[model samples]
Target: MNPDFPILTLLLFLPLVGGVSVVLLWRSPATARVFALLTALAELALGAWLGSAAPAAGPTGYFLYQDLPWIERFGIRYTLGMDGISLVLVLLTAFITVIAMLLSWQEIKERVPLYFALLLATETGILGVFLSLDLFLFYLFWEAMLIPMFFLIGIWGNGRKLYSAVKFFLYTFIGSLLMLVAIIALYLMHGAQTGSYSFALAELVHTQIPYTTGLWLFAAFLLALGVKFPLVPLHSWLPDAYCDAPSAGTVVLAGILAKTAAYALIRFTYPLLPDAARAFTPVIYVCAVVGIVYGAWIAFAQKDMKRLVAYSSVSHMGFIALGIAAWSPVALSGAVLQMVNHGITTGALFVLVGMLSERTGDRESLNYGGLWGKVPVLAFFFLFFNMASAGLPGLNNFVGEFLVLVGTFRVAPGAALGAFLGIVLTLVYTVRLVQDILFGTPSQPMSVSDLSLRESATLASLAVIGVYLGVHPAPVLDLIKVPIALLTKA
Candidate 1:
């Protein structure tokens, strides 16, 4: 860890700084997008550099760490660091932010400046969440992201935007409040035991927690994450939010926001309260399996393209949960890598869906067919991403899901079998989606332009990433192995 250099701090706050500059260009949306893209690209470059500089996997908790005192009285410090897990997520966030900026370039007409600014703000918050090692700091970043996201959905979204925004906000906010309570309780508990106050995660992890207390804290944390993960019954807000939010907003919501829950369970919940995590593992595993099957079944039945993808996210995230429940190095590593895979594959899917909607002026899958005849390039990319999402071999999703199933089978064969069935169910919906949109007889005769150069470039970038990860996922798997090992240690 290099305390001498504040690179992490720059990476964390650079988007916010850029966002303020973008707001100054309120009158010029084109210029705003150019500046925003440059800012996002710069952040991506910085993340790449940081990942390159990261130390090899080892017994140490993290390297490339930064720590500073922010509040003296309460023993809260501005601490940040990254191991293999954090680096991959950081890079994923940076990469996705760039795609999101590109996605909103022409789609967002009203409040253009505000829209780009919110995207940048969301990046800052997500980066802070991934990098912050201080509990207080993490929570601040966690909740700080809501404002921008709320406005993004409410102002720039589709029908029932405001309702979806409020639902999204309330669901997450309620969970965050419970999380706050848990953080404070843990803080006080650590202070009482150590004769000093601190919100440092390193310090808190060492705090001895009673079984009853740990269970309650775990429940609080799990509830908070479950809402964010939108697992099963708590998922009603998710499809509404995804369907109503703009495509760019959907990218962030489905890509990183939900992944945070899986990351949190591995990073904080498991290590901080090992016993509680183990105790509740079976229950959570059941929820994950149910989500897998339920989300797939529901998605298979959806007629709307956007809503179908939204429900598919619920199904994909269920796999992440199943991987976590397995709790083996292979399973955990797969979960971490799957988070990145989901972001890329689904982000591309949403982008393509957005393009289709933009061209046709509708999101209903039933309204269109034989798109391949009109827009071959778009059809090709759509098929490519669909293959990636459906976990075809040699693609990124396959590697993660395969490892997850293999790991789970070793520990819980029944759960693994259920997940496999979910995968099969996913094939049913995803294939049907492709056929309905691209292969069937024309539902409505129409001429549509193919993907523009800019759109092609954007999808091409994501497609390249998907292929590289699919063929050579070793880099990501290698990067995350140490962190998974550290977290799953007895």
Candidate 2:
């Protein structure tokens, strides 16, 4: 709760500042990466303390909030806070950035300095988004990350890297613009009603805008946020970008970036526009259910491993959305916690896929097999993630998915019916991925080795979480329950 020195500000901005300095002070790519990694490590230490010390359970309201008046005349304040949803995300971002640095060790050979710098900068931006309580600060961080991410994909990525980057930037930029307008619209309306201007989410939520106005504001917010969910037709950018980016970039996208939209929906959007959220719950749920089925069906047909993983995210995010839309305590808590699970499980899965691709010099699933016997450790890691993804009974996914299903069934049986189908599809695709990658006949011997010690440490940590949380999810569930309970009141 200490904010005297603005520790969160330092944690969020230092990497970005150091990354920029590396470019100016040390031109060498290796020097850049070393600096970025060093900065990331420092950030991780700070983040670790914050995360571990965060309560095993939280109040139904904000656990930590810091505010300083920025524009007294207009009622704006420089504010930051962490609730149950945010604590996990900020920790995930810092943790994943370190893992991204490790994964980039060999894959990112050229332009290493700029690459890690942008990656670090992107991490800072994401942290800002999660921690910012002021509407203006939130949007600034939201937009700032785009610049680094655009360069990360466009400059250091694959065949359609530029295309993917631009599409990503454009979609999010436009979507976020709409959200910005909504923020302003909400600001002005509330100012008129309350006789003062304010952009604090807490203050704005209490303004009591008419239902009709709330609907439009919600639409604006969702269109901006929803594009990131890349819901169905809007999801065209995710696969290409995922396929084109290097593994490090893709890892951040899957592990952190995409989840931001869903987090916003749960924390900011729903609370601020509850009536609109309630009215649109069924419609949004329909879209989420479609994503569950459609993303899986499309994923089943992908010949490329990266593309398959990308599509699976589309499917997984649908479940995240379903939990949010259901608005039940168990379901929402499950959804919030599942966001962390997805970060660990999916990030590990993609990292493994990238590792195998590096060994084979190809990403096509048909390239080789018989790896299970040859690379048992690698195969073991791969299988663990696959099981987690499948929502296997003893892994993290099962806890979240089960609660979501149980919660949704109580609220809407038809929507739950569609979601149940998604569970089946999840098993289908995950089992196929495991069988094809791990059990296939050996195509050729790999001169490259299995997981490095550092890599193993990273993967093992993620693997342990998947198992530990699965067996005993009470700790995380406790943190998420109060907030979910508070938000779900009729």
Candidate 3:
């Protein structure tokens, strides 16, 4: 990696450029798929190279920092930086985008080129969110990602696509408006105090805010970020959006998009309003614990496999929230690792479920039976990811969840216990899901094919990563150690 090169800029634009090329250059759907896949592959390679070669830290604890003037009048800049925290998320975004493209290859048919283009555009927005160090830049990316996804769901999704897309838009859009207001307020306050109006995160953190004002501002930011995190009560939009969106759309929604909110909580909220964060710790704990149990309890009753998985995400994300609220070094590390873990495992689950739907033309769990005897390979991968989702010992989710629980127990035992019960519920549903969909006699005669090479390859890659991380997460932990320590200390 050359120090002089704008690697982050390249990473950010590659997908956008690829998307434009897909629209203007590719004539057919087939060529468009190839072009999009190749572009995503290139992005992933670049991310991998950067991850391996980039220095551990740079000035101000950011690697490959880029700061240049964007909107000088308002003190906003085109600032981009990647620390360990953002690095892992960047890689996840790249990896999942590729997976999404791969999953879309055969599934998406009408307006294929447009679909791929929107998907890539969404990628750019997500990558921008992770990399942007300027608050204004971050919010710009935040809203930018929403439009493409809205179209992705509206144009291509299943049952109630338009309704789901609108619901998703309204929830996030309202929250974002609140956040934008808070950002401007913070900028003005900072300017009033220091005569230096800026939306730079580093600068904003030093703003002097009165206690009540800090609490109010933190509440606004929390509502905005929490809507995306879909924290408990605000999560009603998710089940519809997740269940109605196309498989690839669902993967991006559950896998990478939701993680952005959690990431923002770490990057912007806690550091910018430490006093408010401490004050609201108890509230966060309640929401996290409730979300965990409530999500799983609902999931246990879902007849639709996709809906079940969607609700399960609420449960899993709650664990991440729990880890964040714990505010310990170990808990924070677990939350970060869990963000990646949930992406891989849940994304894989959606992929597998989509495959099942493709084969049987149905997503109802009761419609499937004795699939293990019929398609052993698909059954294996399905069970593998399910176990991973259930947080079985020696698997990836277990590592993250264990760390979160252990860390949370040190500070909040009652909340930890509530989360543990949620895990038990998770296990129960996991078994029921596997049994209903993979075992027993079919209710009717239905011919279903097994996994193809492409599908198998897609799942195999995710499975390998899950196993590797489960057995040894030292490399990732090491990468994020310094960043997490700094966050904890602050």
Candidate 4:
């Protein structure tokens, strides 16, 4: 809320205003596309600057930290800032927003302006969540962002758009409603104890609640976040939703929504309610390991290409959960890094599926064979992403999963061991997928199209990112250590 540059307000409002502009440009595709890309790119540049400029050690967590009174009586204020962990996620929100827009450039054929407008709105909401130091503001951003996604899936999504959109809405809303109740309870509890009310995260961290109350609060928050992780049984909606949604929409869902949830659990859930998290670790890890194994089992059974990838994400996110449950510092670091790994790798999978569908008119394994021979370039790109998903050596995912497993073995060996078995199952399904889709003989003699220039460029960018992170992750690790060390005190 600092007036100097109004950095936080600028970040939040830019997307809101850009979204409005895109809606106004609804009739012109060319104008809409250009405007949308410009908005996304600008946001990305700003986020990058913010990431680098923020101090390693500062009061509210970053150099840009500041506050302004909103409702003085309630101890509310427009408090916004980032630590290492939050900074990375903010940058991710910006990065994915830009990449998602580019991916949609050629894919979306209608409602261009509305689509991009919603996209920017969604980014704003996500960035708000990452930047806000006030708990109420965080909650507000958390709830507000889902509006655009409901439209993105309903209007631009495929198959049962209404069914999927409504399902996503109801599930998220119920959990968020519970979260709202918890927030109110927190305010009351803080007010009662301190003779003052505050929703600032910094202040709330000091408010001690009984074990029972803390457990209840954690449950409320987890319900909202866990469903988004789409873990195991709660994950039934994902395959259908991702499989049927538009390519860009699927990418955003897989890349951002799930990551947002993972980030939330790490940033807000465990830190705010450490005792509850510890008490609940046994149950949480069981569910996480179950998700890992069960998702792999389902993926192995799926004949739909996109469905396979979707389920794989559930499996990968389960690894994140396990690392979190372990609560070892190293494991937590790996968990943070793995969140990004899942986002990039799975996002790439959806893109490949989209490209394949566009080319050969087949999105299911039952409908494809000898695709590598038909579209070598497409096959090459698809193979790389698949490997990244599988955690092949020298890839982005390998590092995170390895660290998670190693770190967790020291704290929660039982859960980590079970999760390791799940990892083996992961390879089984991923390898089979590659063998079936890329190496098998073609059923039809029809020609398959190669990747377009833009598509290739997009993928190339992703490849470079994977390699860069794989070879040298120290910078990310350095930044992540600060927040994790701080959160440990909670």
Assess every candidate by TM-score: 0.98, 0.95, 0.99, 0.96
What stretches of model 1 exceed 4 Å from their correct place?
A: 1-3
Worst 10 residues of 2 by lDDT: 53-62
Report the lDDT tens digits of candidate 3 across residue range 1-490.
6778888899999999999999999979999999999999999999999988898695466777988998898898999999999999999999999999889888998999999999999999999999999999999999999999999999999999999999999999999999999899999999999999999999999998999999999999999999999898999999999989999999999999999999999999999999999999999999999999999999999989999999999999999999999999999999999999999999999999888887777988887889899889999999999999999988899999999999999999999999999999999999999998789677787777888899999999999999999999998998888889888998
lDDT of each: 0.89, 0.84, 0.94, 0.82
Clashes of 3: 0
Maximum-TM-score candidate: 3
Which candidate model has the greater TM-score, 1 or 4? Answer: 1
Can you give the lDDT of residue 242 in candidate 3?
96
- Candidate 4 residue-wise lDDT, 239-289, digit = tens: 767877778878888887777778777777787788898998888888899
* Residue 50 of model 1, lDDT score: 75
lDDT of 3 at 69: 95
**Deviating ranges (above 4 Å) for candidate 3:** none
Residue 238, candidate 4: alpha-carbon lDDT: 81
Q: How much does each candidate deviate from the true structure in C-alpha RMSD?
A: 1.3, 2.0, 0.8, 1.8
